[model samples]
Target: MHNYFILLISLFLLSVSCNSDYTPKPRGYFRIDLPEREYKQTPEKLPYAFEYPVYSVLVNYRQTQPELYWINLVFPKFNATLHLSYKTIDNNLEEYLNDSRNFVYKHTVKADAISETPYLNAEKKVYGILYDIKGDAASNTQFFLTDSTHNFIRGALYFEVYPNKDSLAPVLDFINKDLVHLIETFEWN
Candidate 1:
């Protein structure tokens, strides 16, 4: 009789607990720690020069036939790199501009939206367009700076990880500020 009563109580308790509504919590991501903003100027030998974040390491882009001016600003912490390719204008400014436009638009298929912001620093003779790509694209930011006569530089920011805008928003925001600073301080050398 005692065993039967205990069993009845256990079943009643189980039934009562199951009656409460339960909702599963959404997924969560790990916290990201961003570094403080600090910049160092590029070496003078390059055709162009700009200030890049101190946390990033400047390395030459490795290719079978790499140009002297093609380099990458690698952010090890974020596993991201900003590729900068320099081209010497030889009456081909229009071609370079078109190439840059095409590169940005290529992300349209995966990009939620793409916005272009023209950057002009007449005193520095720096004119370019900054492409801000929104969504799960391979590249989130791209820009091209040109002197319209002798120098043209195209830059694209890419991450090694899978592209998920939601998880990458904070890092993207942080890097965007550095990019702006780099563009603002850019000068032909």
Candidate 2:
């Protein structure tokens, strides 16, 4: 009887220990769906002419700083936003870039990852910065597109959801394609 009791106690302890040793389930990721790429052209309303995604709309008009203007497109599904900048310049391209960087700096937030890279041509002096902001209440990517002078344009894409680069990757990819299209289509007067 003593031996049987000891055996039962050992079995109970083993079962309890086994139950405590649980393996947590893996984390599930979000599955986001994106839209097809369709573009609509903007009329010759300014110095330059271009086209943007049909799904996106232009916003933010300031008469005071006409030279420094922007168009914002909000993506409610992906919980993201894209800000396209249009700056009428009267200086060197490098100067424009410096000023553009300063402008983007204002929209930047703490707990974010910022990446800057010059794109396309150097002598033509086209440059851009890709902002991947994480943990920000207002997360977005600001694309700097400029003609070096007379024009310092930027396109910013952001999301209201928690900024997870992985989750946002698909949306970013699509928006980037649109952005690239916009840049490719950009022509100076």
Candidate 3:
């Protein structure tokens, strides 16, 4: 009787386990504490100037073959950087525009969609295109500013970690406002 009872209990446990489905939970990222928005102007000698977040550090261009007037805004807390490059038009406005488009499109393979917003300030002679890259691309924002004559500036924001739009949405949205503010305050030196 004892042996029969043990066998019956074991069979009942196996049957119950087989009837239930096991689904794994999704992965999660650590919580981020973002700082309040504050800004400061770039140095006077730079070809162009804009207000950047006070929380970020303005670092000299450190990438390969860094050029004059190229700089990076590093967000240490977020592990991201906004790369800014300057180019003299010299009748190459079309080429610069094409390059900026190409850079934005490169992420299309991973991007769900890409949107472009034109920015024009006749008084300041600052005209540009702002790209909002969606999906899991490496960059969430890219832009190019040109006077259509002499100055052309291109910028892109990149994170150190793998692209995960869902996880980075908050940070991206926060920085987007800053980007827009920068464009609004941009001035040629």
Candidate 4:
């Protein structure tokens, strides 16, 4: 009876030790499906024009900004918007340029790094600066194109969702390519 009692206690101890606590798996995000790159140019009569992705939609921005030519590129799947503001340079090029730079700098507190790439197409008379902001900034890309005389247009890509870099990185890259295509084909009317 002593041996039986010892065996029973040992078995109970072994069974209790073998039972482990339940641990749930870490959280995960849904897989994003990216579409092929296709684009079409804006319609005639606009002061400026650029090719945008077919997957996106162009909507007139009804913001409080005084500019009447403001527009947005809406990416429904990603819940992102590319806001474009147009201004006819009336000797205010310098001020507008500074404002554009300042807007990018506002993200400095959250950005890990900010890099600017200057673009100039002498033949097309298009010149601009492209800013790539890394980290958890509200906007990841911003740019401005100007003829340095008559037309100045600024654009920034922002997401409706929270600024999570890892979750948004792939979408950012995809839109970055579209933005590049737009700039390459941009023309001032």
Candidate 5:
């Protein structure tokens, strides 16, 4: 009766295994390590000067029609870049403001929400709006600063990798603090 016993045991094991529930585990991402915060001032020659993270590398933006004041602040560790474009506001402040707003809204199809945080420093004469775009939009952060008389600057933060809010939340938060610090220290030259 050895064969009979073997069959019974196999059947019992199969039934026990079938009765156990199986659940799929959620996907996971690798942990990200951020660097310590330290900043240095932008070069005095730039039309605008601000303190940026020491971890970032400042490079001139390459374009077919590159403007003198256009530059990029790149974070090599995170594969992200902050593009800064400057324009002289020759009574065209309204136009520049509209363009910045339109650029932020273009990502609404992918953004869950867009929040605007007003930044004003009367003593420094630096005023701007920081746009925090939520979700899988191309750019997670955008901002525009103006002296309201002569200078206007726009900046957008973009990552080289695909945008996944859940995966990139930690890095984004860390960089956001750096951006805020830069804004606070911004000055027109």
Candidate 6:
């Protein structure tokens, strides 16, 4: 009787221990689904324009200066956003380029967990600064595109999130392609 009771108690303890430790795994991030390439030109009313993903919607933001502006290209289906903004320098073109560069300079020194791709190979009529920034998820992909030669048009992309760098990596990587699309297809004409 004693032996049988001991055996039953042992089995019960083992089962309880195993059950306590078992936990279902939490889900990781969902896969990023990117669309195929497509382009549409902007109207002349735009300060400077380029082709972007047709699925993306443009929302204009308040201008910081008379010639400066901000806009957002939101992908509602993807729950992602691309914030594009512009600033026209009063001085020569070089000044605008330099101003853009300096913004990154201050950012680099002060930022925490920042990852930058400082220079991008922007095509003619479009070139400036590019930074692959990640400090806050709320602050995703902060980069600048320029009409490199004339400084007539300079735009920046800021992703909206709290800087969950790990969770946001896929979207950031995916958007870079479209950003490249904007730069290459850029036309000052």
lDDT of 6 at 102: 66
Error of 2 at 132 (Å): 5.9
Could you give candidate 4's per-residue lDDT for residues 57-153 as a string of tens digits?
A: 9987556757788888899988999999999999899999999999999999999999999999999999999999999999999999999999999
Pairing residues by index, what is the TM-score of model 6? 0.66
Task: State the lDDT of candidate 6 residue by residue for 31-92, as single tens digits.
Answer: 77777767677666776778888878877655543433566778776667766656554557
Model 1: lDDT to the true structure: 0.95
Pairs of colliding residues, candidate 3: none
lDDT per residue (tens digit) for residues 52-85 in model 3: 9999999876466357888889989889999999
Over the stretch 75-165, how does candidate 1's per-residue lDDT look in tens digits? 9999999999999999999999999999999999999999999999999999999999999999999999999999999999999999999
After superposition, the stretches of candidate 2 with alpha carbons farther than 4 Å from their true spots are 2-10, 13-17, 60-69, 92-95, 103-114, 121-140
lDDT of each: 0.95, 0.65, 0.92, 0.93, 0.95, 0.62
Q: State the displacement of the C-alpha of residue 108, model 3, in Å, after optimal TM-score superposition.
A: 1.3
Judging by lDDT, tell me the better candidate of 2 and 4: 4
lDDT tens readout by residue for model 2, 1-189: 999999999999998887665689977677866778888877566655567887776655556444444556666666667765676766566766676666557655554556665466565455555544443424445556666556677666667676666666677777777777876676665
Which residue pairs in model 4 clash with each other?
Answer: none
**lDDT: which is higher, 2 or 5?**
5
Q: Specify the poorest-scoring 10-residue window by lDDT in model 4.
A: 59-68
Clashes of 3: 0
RMSD of 2: 4.1
Using lDDT as the yardstick, the better of models 2 and 6 is 2
Model 1 RMSD in angstroms: 2.8
Per-candidate TM-scores read 0.89, 0.69, 0.87, 0.87, 0.91, 0.66
Global fold similarity of model 4 (TM-score): 0.87
